[model samples]
Target: MASTPIIATLLKGMAMGAADVVPGVSGGTIAFITGIYERLLAALKSFTPAALLVLKREGWRPFWAYVDATFLCALFGGILLSIATLAHGIEFALAEYPLQVWGFFSGLILASTIYIGRQLHWRALVVLVAFCVGALAAIWLGSVKPVNIPINTLTIFAAGAIAICAMILPGISGSFLLLIMGVYPVIIAAVTEFNLKLLLTFMGGCVVGLLLFSHLLHWFLQRYRQPTLAFLCGVLAGSLSIVWPWKHAVVTVVDRHGETVPLVQRNLMPWDYESITGVSSAWPGVLTLFVVAVVMVFALEYGARRLQLKRAANAA
Candidate 1:
């Protein structure tokens, strides 16, 4: 972790930011795949009251180093930059090429699930049970129908708090949860319009949620490494349903912009999709993207492994 370059961390952060923008994809999955999940969790977990004491006694430089401020700043800067630049582009892609976009993410998560699963000691009963439980939970979450609630300060804050917690989990998506809570459009509007008051409220909730949840996750990872990994793998596995390429909206809702969008969708087979929706399935293109995404994941894994081995040899 210490030897990782700043640029690499920034790129990883950018990847996470991109994933977070997608409804079914998770930024936590990106962090885990890039081998920085534990480090990221530890950094977030360090912002307790004790950190203030360190700042008071040891001064700025020591405090900064102690909390790994440089790493945080670089990573978060990348995330903010990515979100600012890519949000509209991704929205356009999702609107115009929904099948391809969702197919790519579905493949990414499928490959990630396999990669993470291989790291766990699956022979253990506890790990197996954890995996099953995680899978079931993720499936249930994916099946939840979106609700339209009145948007207010308190609701936005609550949505942020709940969504942020899921955002940091490998299988769950914060954006999807926001959709389920009926605040996703409002949050997107706030970002695009630079609504400072709403953005600040949402961010405050995110801060509180991150601080509270990080400790529990850190403890579980430390104490039950294999089971935790297994559970995360299961989560990634179950999340595939949410990102499946072929889906038709079963329920729709109108947002503030008066745009009618999917509130609930049901997955469909490639063949059945055309029949049911009367839209071309474009199965070939979607399949091609899925294959490309799968290959990209394995390629990334291979490259990361080679880099690790080279670094280990140099250290030795």
Candidate 2:
């Protein structure tokens, strides 16, 4: 039972990191499915004045006691390690059956959209509009082209910071956010090709982002919980534009080092549902896959919730 939680949390982080690497998927969805949503927020929100004072004054024991240090170290380790190892396979798979792959995530996102939207208990008009703003922003982001930008350590660090925040947010895709910021491909290439300079600079950015934004998010949860949730729900709703299964290349051009890159425009997935070709939707297997995926999400949520209860019981 003790081992159950450790395993579930790691796998959840791996799935989330894997999702983060993909273009339209949200890592936060994985976190939610895996039943860690509230705990995740609580963990991030753990930096207390007591902890800071302990750190300033003296010893390690007090700091550790003041913080839920173990969960975070384990969770972050899993997230970073999975991003390094599993991300490559996700990339390769996307290259092959981009449609099918995107389709699976499309289903995941759709289910998530329902789960999140239903959670919104809004009363104020401004908060409702803010939700729309967030969703529309995600839709716009999904349509935008990936831009090329100069790579530098400081800039990459900033990119990492910003992108990490998006990864944890339910509606936004950190990779897509990076694409909009003009560093997606560069960072991807760096990780895939093992370009040391690019990886370190980007990582430096990510570390900064993770630490800084965790604090900001923790604050948001403490104070503006309802508004933040409304905005996140809107994000989940608006992201469907990017995740739509089909896209057309607007143009192709060689990059600085002479690699062909396809610039794309959003197109309806299965372009014509009425004329659904056997070639595209032939896989009746996909239905089973979708069912399995949804079941997996529900199971993770169930198991994680039960485990938290057990952990609390043991603690008590």
Candidate 3:
């Protein structure tokens, strides 16, 4: 099999990183959209006792090839680069242009949900039930109020483990999970300040959690492709709760930086937004951005298909 171009994988990883910076977006969703989801899962799931044995017996080169280390390096390198560069920019956009930014993400997620749902055998009762169950689970999870967990060694470690699991799941947001655990600020601060001790501890948890969760996801996807995809589709559909274009914060919390940040927000209609907030709803601009985002997803898929066909033709 032809290895995916390094540049292409790097670009996809950057896109994933950008999505992950936001509280509502999932890098896994981007990976799925970009056609590397299975490869990523396989690579991550390869880090096992068997791979260690292969390394001990064969060598570093064989183990590296077996685990696809080059691909992982390129992809993760891009993710890290993007997060380092774009974290502040994304934060500014979210704060300054909440409506338009969220509107765009809402469209992306909605289109992704449709795209994934179409691949499932919707006629199957099990698939339908799984979709509904997944949707409800997402909604319930999103609606839960954030908790104020005291920042400690154990909590930070646990937060990393839990959040990294969500990070790799389509429609789940690891940053939001951190928010729920009241550690989002800490993680962000650690990243910004380059706190090596905390960063290392967090990454340790991420590695452990990722390995464990990737195995489970790979197993489920291998055995029950249709139902598993249906569930993911439903989760994507339900994730609209977080990305809704119009919302007002109902609960706020003060961060360690002493800045008041929103903890809970209620979705609102455009007209209701104007009436309540006494500011222009700016619905037209938001709606236009949303439509563009929807079109962009479809366009990306079309281009990907064309690329695959071109590659096949060249190989032939």
List candidate 3 stretches off by more than 4 Å: none
Residue range with the least summed lDDT across 10 consecutive positions in model 3: 255-264
176-208: candidate 3 lDDT, tens digit per residue? 888878788788778778888898888888888
User: Candidate 1 — worst ten consecutive residues by lDDT sum?
Assistant: 1-10
What is the per-residue lDDT of model 1 for residues 1-316, given as tens digits with 9 covering 90 to 100? 3746889888988988888888889999888777778888898888878899999999998888777888888787777778778888998999899999998888889889988988988789999998998898889899898888888888888887888888889979999898888788788778888899999999889888988998889999999889888888888999998899888899887866788978678889998999999999998999999999899888889988999899889999
Please provide the root mean square deviation of candidate 2 (C-alpha atoms, Å).
3.5
1-316: candidate 2 lDDT, tens digit per residue: 1332566567777888889989778888777666566677666656757678887887787676556566666677788778789768887888787767776776677677666666666678867987898898888877677677777777788888888888888868898888777677788788778888878777777766766677777777678877777777788778867876666556666676677766666464453532543345424544555566666656655666787888899999
Tell me the whole-model lDDT of each prediction, alpha carbons only.
0.87, 0.73, 0.88
Better of 1 and 3 by lDDT: 3
Please identify which of the two predictions, 1 or 2, would achieve the higher lDDT against the true structure: 1
Worst 10 residues of 2 by lDDT: 273-282
Per-candidate count of clashing residue pairs (backbone under 3 Å): 0, 2, 0
- Best of the two (2, 3) by lDDT: 3
